[model samples]
Target: MRSIVLLASACVVTTSSSVAAAQNPAAIEHHLRYAVRVDGQPDVAMDLLERMRSYHVPGVSIAVIDHDRVVFAKGYGVAAFGGSKSVDSTTLFLAGSISKPVFASGFLRLAEERKISLDADINTLLKSWHLPESKFTEREKVTPRRLLTHSAGLTVWGFPGYALDSAVPSVPQLLDGTPPANTAAVRNDTFPGARWLYSGGGITILQLATTDITGEDFPTLMRRLVLQPAGMMRSTYENPLPMSRRGEAASGHEQIDTPVPGGFHVYPEMAAAGLWTTPSDLARWAIALAHSYRGERGGVLSPAMARQMVSKQMHQQPPYGEGYWGLGVAVIGDGDSLSFSHGGRDEGFVADFFMRPASGRGLVIMMNGVAGGLMGEIERAFAEEYGFGAPPRMTRTIVAKSASELGAYVGRYVGAAGKDTVRFDVSVAPDSKTLQVYNSAGRR
Candidate 1:
């Protein structure tokens, strides 16, 4: 890793044109043949590269953590659609909402040092710009704990970000939803601590609070208290990355065919959707938290604080069915079965990372494409290959049928009732044992 100076974009160490054999040869072989079962078929395994091509995902970076170590880290595809620069372990990608968890870590470190309190009324700790008084705040105090848990009832689910040459608002301006800011002001609509509502606005408030209490900017405080201590040296909260380091950052793309005109969008909401980082750097942050949870301090968070950080802070379950928000990360299951995870999307970028704190096994994935659905499929492949848990349950079962039976279903079925024309193709797969249904993308 190279020392990056404080500039618009932090300069990262440039490496060779390529990376080591896609991280590991054996793993790649396994992944290619055992990719997640698409549709209802069991033997349908699409290689990662093939999936990228089909989904129009241009670049991806992945790192696997097992037994307290980053066992593998690699990149795939070109950083830009028409360019040859390969995405390697150090290539930067937007952390998106993953910044929330990282930001929570930094805020908790402040709490650990007695610089801030988790349960303190957030408005009392602010001076530069206070959270506007609302009927909601009068009923229940909006504390750091509630804010971290996203129960602060703040508005703005997320930020869309600005183009590289577009106007970028300051944190205060963003909070107030003032001129040039696209979203509404960050204020509570419901009672505090009522339920879970994903609010990037709330996280931005914490960023402001941290800045006010420490008399330091968000990025500087994050560096001193979180990134430096956790050894995430390659990551930064800086937005509109400095010009010098832009070459090392992966270019964001709409899909495989369309890259953003400026390579990537500039996010002014640094706390909620900023943080430029790599998968390897994020794995280090996850591993550090895992280590801390085991009573071994690996970074800024204390053992007790780390446990509470990932513990069940709010009981409101996410609509996804199996997860609930912790202080920052989403915890799946309960007790020893708990695993912490979070997913992020910003413009043309998508990312996700997870870890089983007790077992110290996890993976981090980042891609510079809008094909976020590809991330979940890739995760399914990795999970199955690594034996982290059972393979994803198939939605429907595949039953064998004779040639005559299969032929009966093969044909173009046209809808007669709809004003708009609708058609579907149902055909038997080459193997004869399964059927292939052409989806909206026309892929079987």
Candidate 2:
């Protein structure tokens, strides 16, 4: 594969065959300064673009690294869902838990600087509040590492904010499991690190720890420790401040025919979840990670710290490969090809970051839809085009106990999710190897 390095004022970038196909050399070269390295089959990315039109993803941007350079970087869909505004590589979106790895890096930096201790019990840092006296275990022993790996046994998902009808809990009250414990956010049933539960609260606790350390506000500390150090110029921990402050951010949209309003979620717990960044800015951080791993100097973080940041801390993530959760990131795949990847889903947006450190490959994809949106599709297309894995299994097969046993499973039913009921239908097949599931409003 022939690759050309395009130079601009700020940086050098690479473009793959797909990007070169639709745009002229100058246009492709323009993006080379900041984003996109198209190295794979451009023809495959083009096919995926056709399929994305029906999903209402509106806008999409991809950055792929080929060898030492980013060879494929380009935009696929419209920048905004409402009009014909085309998206570019610089488009920004909410990073969701993708913020975790980034935030965890700050903590690791602090640890490396001898300012914080990862093995110390988090209770030592949390000055004011304390966990309840549980019969299961001593909560005082929970450390920062557990919270980082989600071994802290927080909730499976996140806590839904206090609705209009419900009152929100104070941070101390949230940890104590007082009023408005919606089961997603706070629960007395599980002790810290007893099992694997995905809790934003763990990150919130991390937020307070930083607050305690710096005594400055959360946003200010994060700006200093993370945003500034990582060279995430277009990123901020101060989310949803104003469009003026965050120049040229892409507009968020929901899964609707007409434009849906209020594309933002006011995340009180900003450290674990809240981050808005452009793909171009994020590429800086991605490249810094690669450099750190390769023992390059003047990167965002030190080489030793970077290695610790990606180390597999937990094995409980079964059915997903001794699946390892690092400080705040999930490390996937076997040795030599390990990946640090994370995905985020908010009300009106979904974002994903894929980085293969060994090969120096990274990708960022964002869409203005809810869950079940663009990342999976784009990944599938990438895999198919690159021969990483076979095309996704077209047929899904399931083995059920029996027809009579399936009777109990069939129902015009509602999921026992939470306060609200999600209606769906589940019918059993006597032939087995399949279960008919009616598409529900919940899934949509």
Candidate 3:
């Protein structure tokens, strides 16, 4: 399994581009009104509404921040298909893994206040369910710092969440992977601090530790330490979001354009994937981070801590070769061009945010359907409008090649690394100048 995973890892490179400063609302709106285009395909352009319709996304909300302030925020489409409620700046959508960075900010505040130490063994702070003792902990103990950076060597990359009507697991039950909990037990598989691997299970441990330390529920603690301070009034870590806010919440839609059972799955893994927020609220949180990074007062995190939050903690290994992991976000670029970002995907929601703290610029995008590709198109539109350079353009430059030149590359190739072997065949196209590659399945 490991070798197969390694072979698959060698097959792709992930690239992420940053967004620039914001412009006037009218100009930005005008830019969005025009057709969004793919980087290399000039003919693939669709107007924003048309694109949304084609992608089956029922609703989308966007917020742009420039010079440390939200310059534009709006929503398009209905909160749920066939519903009369329209999405607006205040409409809430599940934030999925974006919850990590937000939760990290609150967790750091605990560290700042001297309530918890980032480097202390997590067992010392956790009173609810202890991280089970294992061989992986012999030398390096799992600590808050390691968990924040996803270097704790823990298992469970993410959760599938519970159906709205299903029984929800307690934090301890979830961690132990007992009945009612849908994931495997959260335990160490590799030596802690050896490498970077994303583990939402690790963040769940933090959630338990935080609640145990503060003697407060996760939602309350986050509101007091992070959301309220950061002016994210519309955000909440509550699972099965309260009924009072239901009218303002967008129903999650599957990729097929149908709403999820009972509107959406309920995520009890609140610290990792259960946040509900508006793009505007997320923008506010991003702005607060920028302020703290600049050493300004009245921010949730201290300037020093905020700096570390966005600094590179560890380089991500292959398959995630695009960037480094900060405390809770992905760090890309460097120095003046540096940016911190995170993307999230739940059962029926997709959200993403990018912020260039050095320049006080960023954008938050939230949608109610599983339209991952559409999110990229929207992001590129924002990039072009705000002048954040487009993602590396993929251009196909045709060069005249002799038949012999193409023939030289036409052959069957087999490569083995350890016990795993990869086999593929290459053949020239009918045009003779083009090449086609096929795997063992004979499909290109």
Question: Candidate 2 lDDT, tens digit per residue, 11-74?
Answer: 0011222322232212321221111223442322335454456455666666654443555667
Candidate 2 is scored at a TM of 0.73
> On a 0 to 100 scale, what is the lDDT of residue 164 in model 2?
29
Order by TM-score, highest first: 3, 1, 2
RMSD (CA, angstroms), candidate 3 = 6.2
Name the TM-score of candidate 1.
0.82
Mark the regions of model 3 whose C-alpha exceeds 4 Å error after superposition: 1-45, 397-444
TM for candidate 3 is: 0.84
Lowest summed lDDT over 10 consecutive residues: which window, candidate 1? Answer: 7-16
lDDT value, candidate 2, whole model: 0.59
Candidate 1: clashing residue pairs, number: 5
Model 1 lDDT at residue 249: 93
Provide TM-scores for the models.
Answer: 0.82, 0.73, 0.84
Deviation (Å) of 113 in candidate 2: 2.0
Judge candidate 1 against the unseen true structure and give its global Cα lDDT, from 0 to 1: 0.76
Q: What is candidate 1's lDDT per residue for 243-277, written digit by digit as tens?
A: 88898899887544778879888888888899999
User: lDDT of all the models against the reference?
Assistant: 0.76, 0.59, 0.81
